[model samples]
Target chain A: MRAALAASVLLVAASAAGWWLTRPPPEPPKVAEDQTFEDMDRAEYEAWMQELGYTD
Target chain B: MLLWLAVLLGMRFGAEHWLPALAAAAEQLDAGESMPVPPKPTGLASLPAPGTPGDGQRATLLSPATCEAMVADLRDVCWQSLARQVAPADPDEALRVCARVAGSEMVLECHADVAESIAVADRARAETICAAIESRKWRGQCFFGSGLALAETDAEYAMGRCAHAEVYQTFCRHDVVGEIALVDLPAAHAQCAREEGDWLTRKTCWHGIGKYLARRDTSEAAAACDASTAEWRGTCYHGVGWGGAERDADATLADCSTRGPYADHCRHGVAAQFKRADPTRAVALCESIQKADTRARCLDFVTR
Candidate 1:
């Protein structure tokens, strides 16, 4: 009876070890949601246009 | 015995408990937190000493603080070199120094500042610098800078002339044109008209003259247009026709009559005018029309 109990415990521990060893690494932190690219105004647009020599 | 075997196998496979225990023992010995210390980064020992020849030359070699210091030193050196040699007694030497320094962004900015200072000290020196730079491959920059300097010094004609130069046209004609408009509209119009073969130049010239006319006398505007080429004349007549049509139909017709190839357009415009003024007069005008299209358009105008 004691031998059978020991075998069951051994199997459970073996499975846990296997699962832990094969687990994927933790993911990196997420970027902030507020970051964006759409942020220029009309004056900035005109300045760029002038720099590029567009008259109209 | 089975439980012992399982524990040994588990340790062989994967376990963090042993790591924490070892970390705790180490920290206890060292009297610190029970956390594993990270190893030093690779290549830290290979770096040269600060202020050494190769220490700050490359970006990757310096730490952030050291990099900032190196950049500051480089900027100071560049400024000193620019101030010293950018205004050499010999024009050619000054140009050579400026060109050499222009390779660096900081030095190029310094050179510009130094050039402005020289312009203020002696206008002749500024012109000489411009002439010297004109011979270099960077003639466009030379012309643009000189034109701006001259414009600032109240040399309107010279500024316009410089703007019309090939180098200035390539780099800054649009900007120069704006400055020219504020200083001398007639000169600007003349310059643009002279470049008539180029469609853009012709259009810009016509537009400039048109704006000038909007605020000036009609006779002056007419003279400006007359001085232009055939294409510009057409443009002027078209503009005047639009403006006149809005104010007076008869005046629009008269303005359209001044240009040919547009005679059909003029006839139609006049026919519409007459219809608006007097339908009977429009029908009478249509009677003597030669072209079938013109006559048909005139009849439609009068009937409508």
Candidate 2:
């Protein structure tokens, strides 16, 4: 009876270890929310545009 | 005994799955790398349409109340128009009007615009006005704008005034020389020749020609660039690539491939121009470049 109990525990431990080891990597961190040009007031919009070399 | 056998078998299978991930994560850690987060795509649809009516013309004087009455989206422009109108007769009033602009940066930009407008009447006063700005960047921009306005009548004097622009000096020369090239190609080329010692100024000078002049005539642009000294020819070709890519990227890439020794630089230009509009395509194009250094350069510009 004791031998059977040990075998059962050992099987469960091995299965758990396998599951833990085989899990996929966590998803990548999310990017920050984007602020559209329309969301910006005129100054911010123009500065962003200028930075992107559009106004030149 | 059966359980022990199953455990060994499970561990073997688990190792297969976990090893690669561990190796990958370890490699990342070793390289001091994190997961790359791509920037969000910018919204370009709302940008103001170029060449709107009265786009470059001076606006008539308007009371502050009139400017205030304009839509919030356009009120700053109205304020700038008022400043420009007031600048010639009373620059101090123009500066005060610029102060009414919503943001500090825009206020400075308005001041720069007023200074440029003043340059049309009195270049010396424009210089004095530009020099008074506290921020170095805005002060440089002011000098550059005024210098550009001065270039219309006196290119050499305008170039001299551009020297006060500090870091923006090359940009001012680029436009001023570009403006000169628009009318006289040879004179622009000669001006660029005088900048031989300074790599940045000389390259940007040729770049201006490719940007402002090459777009008008491809064969002429090619010939003009071909006439450049061997050392700086690649930079001129890079400009041509930028100009060409702005209109048609695929066509520019095709042209770049035919450029032999200058091909990589041309490809770099095209990739840079396409970076904002189509980063994936830019990256793919970068991968196609033959030279490793240029390919890396192209990737750096696009991926960042």
RMSD vs true structure, all candidates: 29.2, 14.7
Q: Interface RMSD of the predictions, in order shown?
A: 28.6, 16.1
Residue A8 accuracy (lDDT) in model 2: 83
Deviation (Å) of B33 in candidate 1: 54
Local accuracy of candidate 1 as per-residue lDDT tens digits, B115-193: 5335534556655554544222233344455454444234454345344334224224433443454456666665565
Mark the regions of model 2 whose C-alpha exceeds 4 Å error after superposition. Answer: A1-56, B1-63, B70-77, B88-93, B257-260
Q: Which pairs clash inside model 2?
A: none
Please report, as a residue range, the 10-residue window in candidate 2 chain B with the lowest summed lDDT. B37-46
Model 1 chain B lowest lDDT segment of ten:
B35-44
Reference-based TM-score of each model: 0.32, 0.63
lDDT of 1 at B80: 36
Name the regions of candidate 1 deviating beyond 4 angstroms.
Answer: A1-51, B1-113, B134-137, B152-157, B160-171, B184-187, B193-197, B204-304
What lDDT does model 2 reach?
A: 0.65
